[model samples]
Target: MKINYSPSKNAFYEEEHKERYLLSGSWPGDLIEVSRDDFIEYGGNPPEGKTRAPGPDNKPAWLTIPLDFVEQAKAENKRHTDEANNYINEQQWPSKLMLGRLSDDEKLLFNKWLDYLDALKEIDVSGAPDILWPTPPAEPAS
Candidate 1:
């Protein structure tokens, strides 16, 4: 029986039994080594990988966003949006005063509130993993 050794797995495969065995010290036990092949045979590997292809060099990258931060941002976004809407609804504009006729202070306050709403709209809460916040670039070789 020809034995095929895989350095990456640190195991040996016997063509006779069509099985792979793990290397423990100097002894090869009867324990069958389970590989990706086994998972495929049993339909263990999920199809999710197909949809989300790996990053560069087939390696996967992950982003860690704090749960508390996400929740707080979402809450703040809702609060600001509601506050802006309420301000618009409660204001009683005079018949002679158009939007442009508003006082400087009123315009500034309204614009500030609208700016907050715009910022909140831009916050992405899809929870999708991203590499936008990458590690600092490595220094160039001297």
Candidate 2:
């Protein structure tokens, strides 16, 4: 029937739901009438990555929430970190073999992997979404 938006909370409130769930919470915005279909399309008041905005005719509108590059970068950083961690986890045992057990070439590859992991740590992902992922070392032979 009618939807109101709270800029402070970045939430949408249906006149009915507001009274039921958020009796004391502030739901600020001139109530705008929208069709039931429109309400469902907005996913119960601006689903993640979206926010409500005033429509051209003073109806209601939804727009994409601005991309958070810093958060994106952090997520990218974590992804790369996790990948490297898994690689090292799976491949490090061969490096721990008894001394002289590994051929010279095998040791070199393992060391290369570790070096890549170290380089990854030094990367500044605060600039995330623009990260240059380090090249993984060639998987070493066991």
**Which ranges in model 2 have alpha carbons more than 4 Å from their true place?**
1-67, 94-100, 140-142
The residue-by-residue lDDT of candidate 1 on 54-139, one tens digit each, is 22432222224556655665675577677666755565323213645777665555556566557657756434232122122232
Model 2 residue 40 CA deviation (Å) reads 52
| TM-score on alpha carbons, each prediction | 0.32, 0.42
- Best-matching candidate per lDDT: 2
Would you give me the overall lDDT of model 2?
Answer: 0.63
The residue pairs found clashing in candidate 2 are: 73-128
In model 1, which runs have C-alpha deviations exceeding 4 angstroms?
A: 1-76, 92-100, 127-142
Cα TM-score of candidate 2: 0.42
At residue 101, give the lDDT of candidate 1: 71
lDDT of model 1 at position 49: 20
